[model samples]
Target: MPNTDREVHLRKAVLWLQKKDPTTKKIIQTIGPCTHKMIGNPYYVLIRSVISQQLSVQAARTMENRVKEYYGNGKQFPKPDVLVKLTKPQMRKAGLSFAKIEAVKLISKAYLDGSISDRKLSKLNDQEVLDLLCSIKGVGPWTAEMVLMFSLDRWDHFSYNDLILRKSIENNYGIPMNSKKEILEFTSGYSPYRTIFSWYLWRASVGIENL
Candidate 1:
């Protein structure tokens, strides 16, 4: 289970990051809100992560809509039982790649078999969650990191493997970042709120928007 006062931890993390490094201060200043819409449900989080993989926001949104339409009402996310029953052709018709369809099936199977559940996941640590998530086909470290940040609300995740983040870090630090390990090391100073730092990096990589 998460610490009782997760928000307190988040606030502490933000303060710690601001004090630890000047670059992080700039990042926080640039990206006004680190906390956005929370993905509280595991099923929705998994679905959104899958839909967004390797796709632009517009494309992902389109695909997500199509999937939701097929599932009906679009309010309730498709359950694992319903998703597992979807044939690859049907999923492909909904704009998902065959690989993604297969991956979704694997995840659904895991869920139905009691290997992955909401309560079970909440009991695991961050690393444990990552490990369990990666056991599913087509789910990688980056995807697992997304689940941790958006779904589980883990405050400290930094996806150094993200290209936009790498670019932002390089620009901020005035140093070329060619290795994920190096990026991880550089982000260590922003402990407990590395995800917030990462959100800032992503925003900075794009453009500043009105808060």
Candidate 2:
């Protein structure tokens, strides 16, 4: 429901996935419809993803909010120009590690310099987008993958870097994460809709009904 514009498209993807893989179908039936939240601002998405690295959900939210409070207006995420001005101490006060602080700065700089503009990225293919984002020193494959799913809404992405997705695939289908070839081969069936498949996998991992 998060992406109203893509509801019909997602429904089609869901049906395709249900037919393509039984494990994914089961996850969809259990978790309900795909509810991938799409954000228009790629810069905001990338920065938040950086902040969330290696942290619990609650802890990451707290830190992200504190950073927003310091550099942003109210609860709104700060713009690249605003966030570019953030000092190391300010980032530290918000619980960002030294590496994370550097990552944040690099992301903000990428936006400001037009190395990764939203408009420009929107025009590129998924691989191109990934390459452009990964060119930044702090942005990794995982962060770039997050942008593809949450920001650009690319449909075919499945991140091997996402531990939750890897675990869910292994738990549900007995596909070991270490077997990159097997994982890619298995997930290839959901091509052009793997993003939806991945969304269901994430929901299955957390037991959405219990929540």
Candidate 3:
């Protein structure tokens, strides 16, 4: 129940994962133990996902800082109600597209109104969480998958639609770009460790120091 205990428990999941897949074992031995912890609110994670859509990492962070500064007085991300109050034009001023502004509004309203509570969402499995989040306006499968892995700490998720993940697989495994079935089958061996594999693949895509 304590935060430290929870942190330990989550890291233990990574150890279990390392044992489950050899590729993961090799990756982690080089990268060191995965230290990712589930922190922050789900609503904020989803909002960031929406804002970062189709943008480079540098550009996305710039836009994200603008939104945070404008709504949160340069202190933190805006609270849900405050985020909802920011009108479309105001959001656009912060670099959000019209569609993304609407998405943020919908997600903020859901957060404010308790439709997307952390407690409720935390209880759902990855697939259920994916389905619920994807029901929102700007949340595609990739966005929902990101939320599941990074926000909720669901370790089994692998985004079939994530281009970076696909590229990583193709380059590392020599799987063809179009071979979705082969990719899925290969990754399935990772089982509960797929997200851990995904984290490594993401690292590999960016040129990990080891390889």
Better of 2 and 3 by lDDT: 2
lDDT of 2 at 175: 90
The lDDT values for all models are 0.77, 0.82, 0.79
Model 3 residue 127 CA deviation (Å) reads 2.2
Q: Highest TM-score among the candidates is held by which one?
A: 2
For model 3, residues 1-211, the per-residue Cα lDDT tens digits are: 5778867875886777678656667767776766655546687678888888888777988999998888887846788888888878888899888998988889988888788877888899877888888888888998887788878877787777877789888886788867899989988977776887787787766743221
Q: Measured by C-alpha RMSD in angstroms, how accurate is candidate 2?
A: 2.5
**Per-residue alpha-carbon lDDT of candidate 2 for residues 42-98, written as tens digits (9 for 90 to 100):** 887888888887776678789889988887886777888877897888779988999
Candidate 2 Cα lDDT to native: 0.82
Clashing pairs in model 3, backbone N/Cα/C closer than 3 A: none
- Deviating ranges (above 4 Å) for candidate 3: 1-25, 207-211
Model 1, position 185: C-alpha lDDT score: 82
What TM-score would candidate 1 get against the native? 0.88
lDDT of 1 by residue, 115-157 (tens): 9997888779999999999988898888888888777777788
TM-scores of the candidates are: 0.88, 0.91, 0.85
**How close to the true structure is residue 90 of candidate 2, measured as C-alpha lDDT?**
76
